[model samples]
Target: MSTLTDRYVWAAVRSIPEKQRGELEPELRGLIADTTDAQREKGVSDADIERATLLELGDPVRLAAGYTERPLQLIGPRYYLDWLRLLKLLLVIVVPIAALGAALGRLLSGGDVGDVFGALFVTAIGVAVHLSFWVTLVFALVERGGVQRIKTPGDGPLLEWTPDSLPQLPAPAARRQSLVELILGLVFLAVFAGWFVWQQFNSFLTDADGTPIPVLEPALWSGWMYWFLGLIVLEGVFAVWVYQRGRMTMGLATLNLFMNIAFTVPAVWLLLTGQLINQEFLDAIPDTDADFDTAMSYALPVIAFIVIGVAVWDVIDGYIKAWRSRNVSDTAGE
Candidate 1:
């Protein structure tokens, strides 16, 4: 037999069970040989005959499936839609919950921003992988076992399909908005809260002895920083609340406005009162022509302006989202 014929026969039988391969390989080689002889008799060249024979047989994997009576796919058409729906449902429900749990655990364990985020990513991926593996395994078993519909003691077929069984889907735009808001809120809060603690132990600015020097006043740790951290936690909780609700409402938006004010007012006040930055750390600067006090006198107003501007934008954005959500609801109702 030609080398091409040998390769084709080998590829087709390679995946068949060992006991079956003994029978299938000889059968496959016979078919290839018979086809090659017929084509050669029709005045085809050896290379052309081999190519034509293999092409007629099509993909080796599919041919193997035919010989073995086994599916090439993990979940066949019978269970594919069901498996897909279940996987989507599990991912949407489980991933966020896993992320939240990981984030909270890391926070309570005194993890910094990097540690908390790393935990969230690793946990989400692990949960997703496990969910996919188990779900696929169960569906593959069902497909192989030739099970039709699962039934319960006092119920109709558990996997039966009906119009009434379809889920009421939320508005896609609103759902996406809520998710974005939740993610951004949680990330912002986590970074600031973690940074507040992390800065004390790690900094780019170091003393002459190479000790870390924090930019924020260490005195704030004794009192004001706790309040800021509390607000950060509250913001995180509010982010979850917004996502769970799936759309902004007037009441929720109002609450968001107040939360922004609560955070930014104190922040601006601290900046203006010269209570935010560490004077000692500034004095430790190696070489600078500009005076620290003169620089801060100009810098504080700009920082205050940026802070107030962000708070104002946040408030307005909340109201706008709430208004748009209300309008969408009204239109849907009508």
Candidate 2:
């Protein structure tokens, strides 16, 4: 066989089982030769005939799949929608529960802010990976086993698809909104980064010697501040991803949820532990009849409440926006 025929045969059988390749390679080469010969009889040039024969045979991957009677995709059309639906549902429901459990366990075990945050992050990621792997493995097996349908309680038959089941594409207005959100999120992160740096050199609070004292603990610069900034950058990247997609998805919403938790839990913990604010800045405050600690004891709960409330609201808002963007009636005539 010519070099072109050799290349084509190699590609086609490379992915096939070794035992089968022995049989398939010769047959494939023979087929290509026969086709080239037939084309040559029609006065085609040798190179042109080889190219035409390869083109007519099409992609090697597909040809190999045909020979093996195996699918090229992990999960085929038969279970794709069902797999996606189940995966999204599990990510939304299970991830948050896992995060909460991890956070609570860390808190109960007297773990510090970093420990709790780490636990939450690791648990969420590990659980999500496990869920995805097991769910996909199950579906792939079912697909290969030739199972036609799955019946779920309250969901009817999984195999039956309808026009009503089609996902609604985001409207133009929704795309515009996502753009606006992306811009605002980037701007906010930029301002936050600037403010964090600025406060280290200049702040309204000053010591007895008139030196500016950062409102945030300077000690955080050692490590925690970098983690906080990294989260901010991640949030900005996520915003761009959402805008590029032109709509919030369940996975994005779940990510937003974890981001919120990651930020808020540490913040609330820092505030409660008196580790968030500068001790020197606190000491510089003019004395009052009420001690600062007493004042903060009453104030910290309120501050924590507001911080947590905002995070919770943001998470809920993301899910709502995702739902609205995906429901046709929600954006109709807009």
Candidate 3:
């Protein structure tokens, strides 16, 4: 007469080790059936037998916990220390390599090596701070049973976590998060724009003569190329903001990313090529003007193509995002 309708109990039954599940199922079913038979013979009503059987088994959640041997916590105390240790290891290995490469690049390119080194130092700290913040949050949530919410395909049956089991983030905290993102986005855009302008200014000062500067400087002609980089970076920032705000359509965001890559490839290619050709390197001598001209003729069109492609993509991507957001707003209103 007794039946197991609780999802947690059923999930636990299914979660037993494959060989164990096969054996446990028959035994548990026999016990339930035998208990019901005994209860009926004792003159207990069918409903009472069912209720008593469930009661004796205790809370389904606790019972399930016993059967499911897998760890249900994502970042428990055991993992937290391990996570920090791994992160420290990564920082030690990656940061110095990045710093050394960046410092060497500045030295070769005739830029401020001290400034580049300082930037590397800030970059390392920034990376650590951001990674630590997210890791700590994951661990905090895991401490409160957050991992149980993740149901994978291999999981035999669903055991849904109730509202009481879910993490509750406060409205003030959510608003503060929004504010922080907005500030960060603005800061990124401002920094990118500033860099673009500075490059253009330096190029203008050096391009006074028709001849190429002794070193690679973004000059009159090269100043135009920086626009391509600026457009790509700006579009990227906008796309990211829209994504975080949940206003970005998936198709449009993908398109934006593609546009960014398209713009990025040629500009970066030319910049790298310039670096390789510059007299500072151990390449095959003066690198004939004919070779440079040949390279430019091929490179300019590719850069132009990417620049145009990005422009068109940005306009289209922006319109698509606006359209989708408007549709969502209308649907919500109706």
Candidate 4:
């Protein structure tokens, strides 16, 4: 009872292995050609064949989906293994560099550089020796998907991939990006730390009380804040890279969310308490305390606002990643 066009399309599907049929989509043109040839030979009209083929193929939207690979995510397949490799490489390179820099910085600043560097170098070598042990342990944990065996039904024990499967390996592509990001992050952290240390040291050499720190006029502080905020934004972007690479474990992800929440929760509590006491400024500083308390009240909110803003961005990123992961699961199911 099958029409020529129906048989033609079936033949195409039949020629493809069920498992790989999803990858052979756009090549289905031959099916139409074969159907046309058969219809011509039988003297069946072209119009009839076209109508029959359209009906046999069902909806194009649904058919097209059958030919595509399921999405792989949480960390996407392309980047998961890469992220793992990156983390390892970063630990090896950055830790030593940071240690050496710290030592050099101390020595340069009159703080026992040689002794500290020597001790740190020796400790690093020890770490390298034991590196394999730790690497193997981490690898084993990743392979196990960070979970114990689950109970299953029937005659034998079973292990299987499931929707809730944890990401253990870093995608190779993501690992490369992570390495680049790590290098940049270290460079930024180093520069900032060095400047900070130097500033503090200079401040110490001068009179005490920190010379009132020149109350950074609006233009100066605003410019500095712009750069600082930019750095924070960059860090947030890199965190997304990790999330996309599936480097975020549920425990770590929750902790990240919790820390952000904690940073903001105090602000809300202060407002509530301040309103309750009907006091404009709480604990109105006892000594020259008035000046100190006033400074803190002004400074605290600004710092808190920056922290909360960054934290909110991080939370949004986590949610986005979680959503993408769920979609990947659904695609795999399909």
Q: Pick by lDDT: which candidate is best?
A: 2
Per-residue CA lDDT of model 4 for 73-92, tens digit only, reads 33333333333455466454
- lDDT of residue 63 for candidate 3: 50
Estimate the overall C-alpha local distance difference test score of candidate 1.
0.71
lDDT of 2: 0.75
Give the range where candidate 4 is weakest over 10 consecutive residues by summed lDDT: 155-164
Q: What lDDT, from 0 to 1, does candidate 3 have?
A: 0.50
* Predicted structure 2, TM vs. truth: 0.61
RMSD of 4: 16.3
TM-score of 3: 0.27
| C-alpha TM-score for every candidate | 0.48, 0.61, 0.27, 0.32
lDDT at residue 305 of model 1 (Cα atoms): 98
Q: What does the lDDT read for residue 11 in candidate 4? A: 37
lDDT of 3 by residue, 1-334 (tens): 1123332234446434566666655555665677667778888886577655555554443354445555534455334434554565555555544544554465457554255445555765766676667766765765455354345343222333231221111135545765676678677767766665554334322333533233334342343344455554756566465544444444444445544543454345556556323332212225556777677668756766766676567667566855765554444322
Q: Model 3 misses residue 267 by how many Å?
A: 2.6
**Pairs of residues clashing in candidate 3:** 203-218
In terms of lDDT, the poorest run of 10 residues in model 1 is 161-170
TM-score of 4: 0.32
